[model samples]
Target: MPTFNQAYWEERYKNDQAQWDTGTVTPPIKEYIDQLSDKTKRILVPGAGNGHEFEYLVTQDFKNAVMLDIAKEPLANVAKRLPELDAARLIHADFFEHNATYDLIIEQTFFCALSPELRDAYMTKAHSLLAPGGKIAGLLFDFPLTEQGPPFGGSREEYIALFGNLFKITMLHRAYNSIKPRAERELFFIFEKK
Candidate 1:
């Protein structure tokens, strides 16, 4: 099994092997952000590599938002682009160990990048980090669970099974607005804490 540790991810960035990074916020997430009426919601984009979505939130005036990542390189990259951003908003911490509450957690490439073994843990941590009735919204990779990945794939059944207990599945369907490369493979979902 690939060791999905901090060092492992740090090296992926150093080696420029982070192909999952689209270098900009993708359409599905942008649409989700566009629909959000509450600008002051405390939002988190954990494992937010390069943090383009976080950057987008900043541009849209989402002041109460933060992006956390285990790798400093990506966070540093985000900082370079948004130089005026508050330094504290770019958090360098492990997601599971990080302490805070948020009204919304944006999921993009983050979940698939985690080891399959950590799926349940990710779900539990997300539940804990959210405020009451808080939401976790974004895309999840929709494919067969296979060994060949840091970009591990999972089926719809798997997601329903894993998140069902702690979250109310408000939306869990294949994304209609994915970019060319991601079009049939991403599920845009919104899960509200139970």
Candidate 2:
């Protein structure tokens, strides 16, 4: 398997090959944010390439939001784009090594970007990082899983099996608001820590 580590990602950024970036906050996540009533809950967006989600959160008056990535380029781009947000909240680090807790941990393309062997580690770390009843909400691809991608795909059943023991699966179905190319290839899910 190809390494999906910092060097691998950083090279992708350096070479401008990040095709996974949608260039804006994804619609389903935006819809999810629109229904949230609390602005004080801590939120984390790991592997936040280009940081559109965190930018949307900050602009919508969410007081505590963090954007993290192993690659510095995207974080630098985010800083330039969101000059008003505190620099301390833009973390450049590995998600596995990150040590902060949050009330909500947002996922985007980060999970699929890792080697499949690390899925359990990702699950365990996500559980550890969240406070009691904390949630993880976002899109996961719903296609065949093959060895050919950072955008690795899986099915709803796999996701349910992966997370059901540690979380309450509040929502997991096809996303109605995905952008054009991703329209039928993703699942919008919310799993609250149990």
Candidate 3:
């Protein structure tokens, strides 16, 4: 397996191989934000390639939203397009190494991009980053797990067992509004930290 280090990701952006980017926020995440009454919640969007979801958050008047990416390219692209975003909010660092607290954390395509062994650490970091009763919500790929992916996959049963220890699975089901290409392959989840 190739080491999915910073260089690998930077190369993916530099070479324009980011097939996972949908160019806009997915419908489920958009709908989730649309219903949220709090425009001031502190939000973090980790591994935010091109930052479309975070962009959507800002457009909805969410004041404290931020997006972090391990690679510079996507963050730079976001910066170029959205100059209103605070420079400090567009972080370029390893996700595990990030240290902060938030009311909500967004999971776009980040989880599946990680090395499978880091799943436990991802959960721990996410939990640590959340304030009391805060939530981590968004899409998770639902498919067979195999060695052939940066967009690696996992089943719903596995997600429940993996996240149940530290988070209450408030909602975990197939996203009804997933883009056509991702239709039955994604699960929309709301996992509140316990």
Q: What is the TM-score of each candidate against the true structure?
A: 0.98, 0.98, 0.98
Worst 10 residues of 1 by lDDT: 1-10
**Clashing residue pairs, backbone N/CA/C < 3 A, model 3:** none
Between candidates 1 and 2, name the one with more favorable TM-score. 1
Give a tens-digit lDDT track for model 1, residues 1-194: 86888899899999999999898999999999999989999999999998989999999999999999999999999999999999999999999999999999999989998888899999999999999999999999998888889789997889999999999999999999999999999999999999
lDDT of 2 by residue, 65-104 (tens): 9999999999999999988778999999999999988999
lDDT of each: 0.95, 0.91, 0.94
User: What's the alpha carbon RMSD for model 1?
Assistant: 0.7
lDDT of 1 at 6: 86
> Could you tell which candidate, 1 or 2, scores higher by lDDT?
1
lDDT of 3 by residue, 65-177 (tens): 99999899999999998887789889999989999999999999999999789999999999999999999999999999878898999999999999999999999999999
Q: List the residue pairs that clash in candidate 2.
A: none
